[model samples]
Target: MRGRLIGQTVAVMAVGLLAAAIDGCSRRVTPEDFAEGEGATAPAEMSPQQERSSAQPTGAPEKAVTATDPGGNRNHQPGDKEPLEGVTESTPSAIQGGDSSPEPTTRVSRAQRTGGVAERPQGRPVQGEEQAGAVAPQVDQSQGLGDQAVEATPTVAPADAIPIDQPEERPQLAEGAAAADGTDDGRPAGASTAEPFNPLRAGRAGMGPLRSEGAGGEGHPAFRPASTEASHEGGRQSKKYDPIAENGPIFVGWPKPQLALVLTGCQNGYLEPCGCAGLDRMKGGLGRRHTFMSELRNKRSWPVVALDVGGLIKGFGRQAEMKFHTTVSAMQLMQYETIALGANDLRLPAAELLAVAAPVDGKTLFVSGNVALFKFEYGMTARYEVIRAGGRKVGVTAVLGKSFQQKINNPELEIIAPEEALAELVPVLKPQCDLLVLLAHASRDESIALGKAFPEFDVVVTAGGPAEPPLDLAHIDGTSALLVEVGQKGMYAVVLGFYQDEAVRYQRVPLDSRFPYSPDVKLLMVNYQDQLRQVGFEGLGVRPVPHSRREELGAYVGSQKCQSCHEVSYRVWRKSGHARAWRTLVHLDPPRTHDPECVSCHVVGWNPEYYYPYETGFWSEEKTPELVDVGCESCHGPGEAHVKAEMGSDLALQRKLQQAVTLTLEDAKKQQCITCHDGENSPDFKFETYWPKIEHREWEDE
Candidate 1:
């Protein structure tokens, strides 16, 4: 579950990773490598030896630490597990050496080693190291695999619970949580040593016991309220989940972006009902686009732009949606200079969308070559414009695909073969613009055809069509043109980077809604939540909850204080990354830092804290546990009944295991890691520096 986010650094080992003092030290045990992963820890926090370990060529930022726990030694499986059995470190194992910027290459999956046996059916080396028909082992076994692997189970829940001693930033619940008996019992707020805390009831109602309501007097769980407190605790030493601090927009020294395009609006039969793609809600807002775009822009000087290739929100019977779907809203938030009309966005009886987009302050430009202004016929207009930057002029425009003409509504909108339209236009318009950039909501096949139809064009940024994992750049008539897309609901954006001229080539970068937040955006999010809720989108399956999952647990608690005895886990919970998912986005202190833009994914507290006004940054009024980071409610569901169930002794380990549902094993671990790893969610997440140290006695894999 290695994640990608802006400013996250990877180690090439030694020179590649920058470890200052990790080599030659005795090995220590690290916490179980939960499927989820992290960034290199902060420099200031690294132990001298640990720092040296990072400087290795293996690119692994972390090395096993010297065992401090009374238990055996570090890096050994808890049950001994026979030294990982027959496995040995393989060759070309993603070693970073001194190189940080890795030109993207095909690599193997991490699951191959972590869980799934490597696909290799090993055979003896042909002769010696001499190659005969040796299939060089590919794919690194550390980063996990592709595909959102969700290990689904009947999710039982505990009250929103977190450790108290953790950073004030950790997620937590109320104090005096319930035991098997519903009566409030004392539980350690921050210790992982406490007995299993399970809820009394089952289903969503059973998770109440884990919530931490009464541990601290302030009602806010006890943890990092200020940096001074952390400084007092040996400066950076006491911090459990500390992030490695680094500066970015580092184009010259980082890996080029890997890109993907996913379309979501089409019905199985064609264009009809919308699909959630199984997501709880759709989150494609224009403002969000700006952050993702800015990140990609900062990644490379290569030209990058995202366009709504159409169909997204097309079925929204609402006026704003029909009229170019916040076309104005998108225009306002989407910083791209060019926009093409998706059939759904343009099929409105009236074209008010054009007016809405007409005067959106110059930076956002519009384009369409196949549609006549106010006519049902095809004619070119000043719809899209190109830019001459870095000595290259890339002309941008759009045309509805022929299939859309009168197929649905708005027969007045003319549609033509994309090839026909481009053929008629590119030659005539070729000299008018330097690079031809098409904003088509057409399918991938059509996009490919369009690219081939006109060798005159340079790049195609499309949306609205369904696609597979990710598509790379393709050549059309010997010129370089690439296809770009972002999955529906603003989940991701595909950024293409090209430099100098047509023959120079380009690379694709990926941008998603995971980055630091600004105050202004926070206020807007609050308003949007209310708006969506008012529009009946809250329980609409995937509509996002403005608060984190933890807050929901808090509100679920029936004024019963759950933090009387179980104090340790609750305290440690505060420092967990889960609690701070929302805060990182709005905090933004670590410029180009980690943060989460989506609120629904976080476990919130009982309180909803966020207010993003336009002019100002995230105002204090809008900040809350749900928006700030991991809260007790994240892991737990609402807790009122679970408290009662605990009062009844219904809590059990069996019940607890059934309740924690996540995409993949790695996904679940990643979620847990989100409680602290930096970059997007944990911008400062460092491996060797802050990775929990441990020791274990080897045992047979039972």
Candidate 2:
């Protein structure tokens, strides 16, 4: 596929060059023009005495002009028996050198010849003869298309024509040439080396090839002067992806990019995808995201402003606090400009969060419109923030959803409705900044509603709720406001390009196995983990026990143990989707099978501290291989006692096992499957639709 793609690119370039060469010969060059070295002389701009003496007599015999074809290798010289293909010799009325009887005139360009060489004087550069900073004059059809007409009338080019290609001897400095005072050579006089021209690189010069205006230049009649069209072609060549050329914004000319905003959301205290590496490595976390942002900043070298919808830390423990601090400190090094407030961060004590949220080196600001501590402290939480980026004032504000606001009841914290907060904040922020952005950590529907209500906002970035695919630039139907969202966790980052007087363009970059971890962030994670082991959760002022307190559920027995009686059922479970859920995480970078949030659905009977009930379940790899994924025990009840009772001589225990084991198909389809297959994890889940894929009850105990 790669080879085919490269071949296609080369083929396209070849065709374009062939067409350009043909266009170059639109007004053919003859040998008599080259014999006299018409195009080889210096500029024809001379005194009246010099011009009068150079004119030839009208009665002079015509010079023998050789016709060279622009075809395959071979020269077509004077008087070949077979005139060059599609070409016939003809002489001007005054000069008679060819056959007297009129021959058919073939209006063929020099490009039509199958084998012909270009005729020009030796040691003359094709592009250097034309005066720098001068436009080529319009063609005079009555005088014919050749060097004679151009030499007779010398003219200075327009101010904009070929300005950058002006010779070193020009009076004024050209647009792109080296400083006049610096060096005698046209290159920069200083020791600073000249860099290769790149359209995407900031503060660079020489965007395209220089050409004279109109069609005649340096004794060539067919060539037209370079314009924005050349710059556009140069831009297309510089980048692998040219959004402008690919049905995106149609830029009139080269426009400098102002700023690049890298956006993120819902980190959930994930230092790495999981600790595992190799094939099991998972994507995302601070390490990979930092790597992506840093690399992009270095390449573009534009002002990179990073914003997050928040939720950096997932839990309330010393580990979570340290992780949050580490993540924020790394973000500071990464040069993040602003971060919106999320409810997850508010779960921590006011003092700890305040210390962490404090401006890092007075650069990264935390913006929130509704979130406030102890009746809205100005220093802790402001209604909005105005920041100048790439010479433009940008306003940033955040609003937490009502669902999240209800989680905080402490009188020290005050949460206002997003609508109320925006009503007061929008008017002030709109007037202060060129672009206004609101971080709306709410449901998708709620975010859209906010965009419609506040058309003054230029962008709305949503966080929380079911992880959604990156959204396109969606307008409010009646307003100019646009809405977009990144998936949950730091799995994706939206890179936005801001240009002067143009709509913002964005690309959704997925932080997956393809991206590598930053060494600095990786080192930070290692140190944080080391600290975690030394001072456990209890030492960090967090409850060490699981959140779910339920203890009535039965113990899990290995699926292999069930094979003794229900051999067919075990085979069916082995082939089902549930059996390989753990491996799915293992295949992902950093292997997220160990992650509590991911493991809950992938593995059987997982119980994280924040949600769900605790039960005897798969503890670790070495201890519970059978309970690794959803097996018989996951859909049915735990089978340790049930399996033992059937094998033992206890009549009463066996009777209890029979009753507990008889779960109707409806029970499993309606409730058992829906538990883990709901939003965020599986948005398209339909229990009745999906149950048939794994339904296996053909075999039962006699």
Candidate 3:
């Protein structure tokens, strides 16, 4: 009884002491003690390449494809126009996909307008013509990016004269799914896949040989990104630039007080496979661009204007229709900008093009005083609209490609000349917008004629030609106009900075091997790959199947697993991105990210999927995803067959998976990256773009 009483007394005394202390303090808890957090951080941002590097090998068994290489990267002087929109008439498909002029902003007197040329109302549109919201017809370009009116039938065109626009319509995502396996089956498949890799025997997904960080786990404490984002996102950090600001107008005097400018042909027709160059299967899409632009202005940046030059693709492929659908996605990505049509611009019918571009904010501005789509014999061009870019009243006019004058066997089409149009409106358009830019489909030569015809003009971004643009300057009739080219096959991405002074310098730095790749990409690959090992790459033979076949490749399999057998070659191949290629695709943002033209090296089970990164959308259980790493079989022949080679001697093995291969180094590079990337995929694909595709053979490194 005495002990219990004493314990109660002590507790009472302690409580009393605590109460007295609290009374002496400011309060129970001052606001400073629990201040609300002012910021939040998730992790790092990685490039697509870095995103795939650390993936786990899942998917199906890889089959070496000898026929058509999806990564047939090529470069060309802005080639002839691709077909209009959608798939070929012979091929079934979905969506459709089109160029313009300037308005004067100077407050002119009503008396002057009455005395000069006929005064049209301020709101009247010029070249972006169409019956308001009609949809664009889908036109498919079959083989290469030639302007085909149909889907690919495995035929090659003569190298000389090229065909122009044709239209077709198809679903957009279907193309991404199809391109994942390099096929045109219009199947529903996820476009993501892990690169081929041989784990130290499969355990869980993504837990590669090393530990992993999330896609947002790049360990760069030094990087401080712009603190702004889009309506659908969180804060995004900006890329670090060297800070080369020379005077006021940045990026070619963009979106001047009264005028804004936009450049396109980035991925118009399809999503490229890997890089940010050209469009392929509609995979390389707005999912990222939307995210990018959303942040562009959130950082106290100015509103940007937009435009497209042309040749998103060869214009005839299975996913051609889907390419046109990009306008819908683009509208979603940009949200508030107006766009003009291009030459291949009319490949898809005009009514449909308007429908796709309708939803975004801002007034529609179609600036073209020349080139009209046919409506009976009158040349019905009274359809374009006008819009504003910064606070200034800029006008736009879209000119139809000259090919419209050639022959689709349609005589009703009476194309007007751009030269005459410029001559007639120089005085008017010059004063309307503080700055003027043209989205022309004619060759640079034609643009020069138009530029010289109107010295009042500021710039002209052009397409439609056969001569390669120079890496340095855009010379239009000897005038230092800015000319840029993002080639095809998704090879690279470039940011062209323009200054107001005549003494400007622009250099072409290929996104090839020479670039000091961001460590962010590699870090992301390592992290996510380990996290999602269940999903596979190529979607054929997954990790659980066991890649023991490699041990049966004749003398090549001299020992046990990779650590024991083919030690030297295994080590080299293991580190190479080839093995991790498919995984890279698997780890992409999604169905919207897999462009056939872009994922040449990203496909798994080449012969089986018939499409790399093979799918329009990943339909696996809702949120579950997969790793995307380069895997084992990319550079090597498929192990399934190589394992069957036990019946042959070492010589046979050499003949097949020969480390002593017959393919020359140069040949391998071409087969890998040179074809499509050169044309419209990468605007800056130089010899540098080709270098990274070529790896140093181990012996040479020695």
The candidate that wins on TM-score is: 2
lDDT by residue for model 1 over 198-302, one digit each (tens)?
110111010001112112211112111111221111124322332111100101111221111111222111111111111011123344345545433332222
The lDDT for every candidate, in the order shown, is: 0.32, 0.49, 0.33
- For all predicted structures, in order, the TM-scores are 0.38, 0.50, 0.42
- Give the runs in model 3 whose Cα sits over 4 Å from its true position: 1-305, 310-314, 331-338, 349-354, 357-385, 388-392, 401-414, 420-437, 454-458, 464-580, 591-599, 604-702
Task: Show model 1 residue runs off by greater than 4 Å.
Answer: 1-288, 295-308, 312-314, 319-331, 347-352, 359-364, 376-381, 404-407, 464-471, 477-480, 485-489, 501-507, 512-514, 532-702
Clashes of each: 191, 11, 165
Candidate 3 per-residue lDDT over residues 335-435, each given as its tens digit: 53334445444455555545553323433433345644453123233222344533333444545445443523334344566666555555565455434
- Report residue 567 deviation for candidate 3 (angstroms): 8.1
**lDDT rank, highest first?**
2, 3, 1
Worst 10-residue lDDT window, candidate 2: 84-93
Winning candidate number (lDDT): 2
